[model samples]
Target: MNHFPLFADLKGRRVLVVGAGPVADRKIALLLAAGARVVVGARAAHPRVLARAHAGEIDLRLGEFNPAWLDDAWLAIAATDDRALNRKVSEAAAARRLFCNVVDDPELSSVQVPAIVDRSPVTIAISSGGSAPVIARRLRERIESLFDHSLGALADLARRRRPAIRAARPGLRARRAFYDWLLDGPVLGALRRGRPDEAERLLDEALAQAAAPPRGRVLLVGAGPGDPGLLTLRGLRALNEADVILHDRLVDAGVLSLARRDALLIDVGKAPGGRHEATQARIHALMVSHARQGRCVVRLKGGDPLVFGRGGEELQHLRRHGIDYEVVPGITAALACGAYAGIPLTHRDHAQSLTLATAHRRGGACADAEPESGRTRAYYMGVERLAGLRAQLLAGGLAPDTPCAIVENGSRSGQRALYATLENVENQARRHAIRSPALIIVGEVAALGRELAWFGEILDGEPATAATARLAAA
Candidate 1:
């Protein structure tokens, strides 16, 4: 941020170059591309430079360094092999107050050329002044990998259709949201295949259907637990189509970034163990209001909505209001936490059955929760109610010696884990500093960590082993 950003107007401006070597040749190319009329002031030219002069692309002068070269020039470059000559060019340009770049010499130059990524109409330039051109070039190479050339064409198409979209949506927010949908949806494919026309046609069709701007439809989208990548394609489609996203506290930011930029993001999240009625009511209104006005609304929820994610309740509300809606299933907490953490929900030697139960609240106390019969049980949000969960499981005849594991921040970078028997699960989890966004498993199959742990080994850079606590902290 040391230097302010500026764009120079080069069209038809004169550029004077004091060398015809590779360095000067590069400067000449950039100037010519910017449409600057270039004059090479060197006595002899490289074959390429001589060719360019003969082809009338540049005006070549046969002479030693001369101060008169700066007379009518907007910019000048001193790229000669002789440092004395380069210094002379610098002093001449400075006296005349003209911008000058002395090749590879920062102290004598007014400006330094930068490494550039040009997808014309979408150019990215990286510069370290003249201090580190190598670093600048490396960064440019990295940036060049992030965006494809098709983006320029895609942007052009959108620009070309601005008038039509304005006529169709009228509202600024609506128009912006429509473009967001296009960028996140099939338009990218069209642009990649060199089908801008088809992409434009499809977009026009979608906009035309917006005769009323596709009314808000409630989509119960599962933002697969905490791992953003686990979200389903259908869920991604819902997010892209949404005009608003009503999310909970548990939904990851990485997942939310996939939402339309202009979409209204409403955080209806509740505290752990807090009431959800008000949140649900507010979500209901946003969905209904936008839908009534013909907006695509997305009710973004973490984990599989049907599996204790209260997705059914939202669906029920949408149904009662007669709102168009559908559910996009996300990777459930039970499967995601256990799988990514290297815990097998069902193992051949120890677990013959799998079960999932909420540990947060059950009718009043965890004691009131139903006992799931299985070799393994994944308790969601159950840390605070662990004692109660243990009692309920013991009461249901589960063995106290059963292996149990806790996985926190499953599949996220800071994931932690703890492994212990059912009798010591809560205690071990506490000692190991297990926190929320965690899943607890109790059953013989949990002991299968003696084998099936892949993610844990990858994380610690160790070979797979029975003692890796694979599922607990993976």
Candidate 2:
């Protein structure tokens, strides 16, 4: 590193700022936050600086730059636009052996402020050696995304219990392992889930028996609708920290690739016309077994787990097994597909409410759940049963001309939206060879997709006359 990076302790120390413009005001604010005594020497000052002076937060001296300003300062900052004045400040600080930062003039600055991501007790700083500040800022943004805000709490808790932790794990290696467990295991997870008491209990439990086998837990995380970008931050963190992952087959490969490199991946997906009950039993067994072995188990499923994804059943199974678990919600297919296909499930003019159902329920049971007038209906697994759905809707006295849409692959890059009327929906499915993993939407709002659709291909399955009329209206 060309410049040594260190966090200075300036608490109650005098720091001199040469110039009181906006830039100086910003530096002074940082100085004040760091508990530094600030003395400003400038030809003029920003109104905020004057206000701070009046408030006695900073001592403002309005006059020409003076070398005497650096006499007692622990650090100096030159933020003036004038190059000569900045150089003078830099040279004076150099003569006094005081570190100085000349704003926007890296060559003259002995200290360069780095972009900071402050999770309080857990702060991260990024610098490009004063050569690429923008790059440093971008790096800071990525770090901010990767770390949870609860990290500060986790850090503080560790600090408070450091003596206990040290006593529990006397060896250096043992202490390091304990710290790793604190970071990757249930303690941090508990904090992230907003159970600080539980987190404290878990930490205490660990400290009580530091040599015992680590406790295991399960995180049921939603992978979202086929798009990795839709995955939640908590879900990503779980995947990265997982020791074992029991994932559905439909979970995106891109999502799987984000897991810990050494994590064991087990496919527990069930298929139609397959032994689903047995498969579900096996999944439950795997989750319980891995977690019992002190592994961080992730039951990764596509879309929101509770929304017809059997998440509730899995949670029930986990509870029955006495396994510690947390649920991370994902963007459900109904919402993701509706947004991607530009079909608002509920619109003021077209639809007042939305009904979600599955097509495979016996005896046309889902038909009873059909949306009323001025409402929209979405079927999760109906692409294969479109003809039966159409017939059921007709038998239920629904309008033959009701707009329908089939959203395939939802938010994926290859997603497609096929539009048709209730009467012709079956025909359109047959013509387009529509497949499973598609959502079916029915209502007047489905018709608005043709006009509002922005992402993916839109296929019109309406009759030529109707299509011509709609196009003319547009």
Candidate 3:
């Protein structure tokens, strides 16, 4: 470490700022937020600084560079355009044994300010030892997105209950376990939902039952359709807290990478036409076994678990065994595929309603649900059943020329959107060799994809016409 990082307590302490520019104003604001008694010694004060001085918020001494200003200061900051003056302030502070920071001159300063992500009581500081401040700031930005405003409230709750928690569970291990429950259980959920009273009650209830062994729980998380960025915040939290993750084969590797590094990952994915019932039974057994051991189990499924992911069956199995569980919804393929393909599922001018269905059903039978006219229809896992789907929709009264789009590998790299009408959709699929993990969109709005297709335009791959050549041939 080039510099030893330490958070100073500036509450009621005098800090001197030797400039009146925007940079000095920023440092003064941070100091004031930390309750510092700011003393500004500058040739001329910035408008904001002058305003604060007039309001008696800070002490302002308008003058030339003076070493006398460092007399009673605990810390000093020199943020000026003049290099000589900034170095003079740094030398004066060094003589007085005070830590000073020179803006844009790291070598001349005794201290450097770090990039901060403030969740109040849970503030995170990132420092690059003044060697790479931009990199430090970028790192902080990435970390800041993972945490929300509720983290500070959660910290406050913990602080207020520390005394009671210590009294209830005096043993360090037991107390730590209690805190884990507080953070990973319903108390944190209540806090996230903006229910502080409920959070408090939940915490109290858990503390009252701290003597008992912690119960295991399961969270059914939707990993979204291939893209990790589409995963919900709550789903990400569940993955991070999981002791064991039962993930599907289709769940993107990017999504799995976000889980706790040490988490036990079990592939519970059932291959198409491969002993489906046996695979499902094994999934149920694994969830029950791990959860019974008081482990935090995550059932990570691709897309919205409830929509064709057999999430309902798993939920029923958990309920039958009396296991505690919660569900986190993900972006299903129909929604993600439609947006990425630029085919709005519902448009007032083209489609007033939307219908989601599956073309491929159990036992190789076409799903009996018929697509109605006027509403946009999206079919999941329909790549193989394109001909059957087209026939069924036509029989159900959709026009032969109704526009359609086949979105393959939706929301992922190498994603392709093939545009065609109902009459030639099956031909287009066969010509382009469209595969599974693709969605079938049928409606007047599907035609709009040709004009509004944005993702394809930006991506550096095959042109949209390459996939839609069959339509052009027709």
Q: List, residue by residue over 1-474, the lDDT tens digit for candidate 3.
A: 578889999999999999988899999999999999999999998899999999998999999988888877899999999999998999999999999998868998899889999998888899887888899999999999988778899999999999999999886546757877876788878988989999999888877874766578899999999988999999998997788999998899999999988899999888877998899999999999999988889999999989998899999999999999999999999999999998888877668888788876777776544556558888888887788878877887777777888898899986888887887888767888888888888887887787678774322122456435533532
Model number with the top TM-score = 1
User: Per-residue alpha-carbon lDDT of model 2 for 1-474, expressed as tens digits?
Assistant: 588889988999999999999999999998998899999999999999999999999999999998998878999999999999999999999999999999888999999988899887777889887889899999998889989899999999999999999888876546766898998899999999999999999999888873855678999999999999899999998997788999998899989999988889999888878998899989989989988887789999989888888889999998998999999999999999999999989987768888888887655565554437888988888877777788888788788888889999999888889988898988888898877789999888888788788999888898657844643553
**Candidate 2: segments with Cα more than 4 A from true spot:** 1-213, 362-364, 369-371, 463-474
Candidates in order, TM-scores: namely: 0.68, 0.60, 0.62
Would you list the rank order by lDDT, best first?
2, 3, 1
| Model 1 segments more than 4 A misplaced | 1-46, 53-161, 172-213, 365-374, 448-474
Residue pairs that clash (backbone atoms under 3 angstroms), model 1? 43-63, 210-213, 214-294, 215-294, 215-295, 216-291, 216-295, 416-473, 417-472, 417-473
Model 2 quality (TM-score) = 0.60
Q: What is the lDDT of candidate 3?
A: 0.86
Give the candidate order by descending TM-score: 1, 3, 2
Task: Please write out the lDDT profile of model 1 over residues 24-56, one tens digit for every residue.
Answer: 898899989989999999967899999999999
lDDT of 1: 0.77
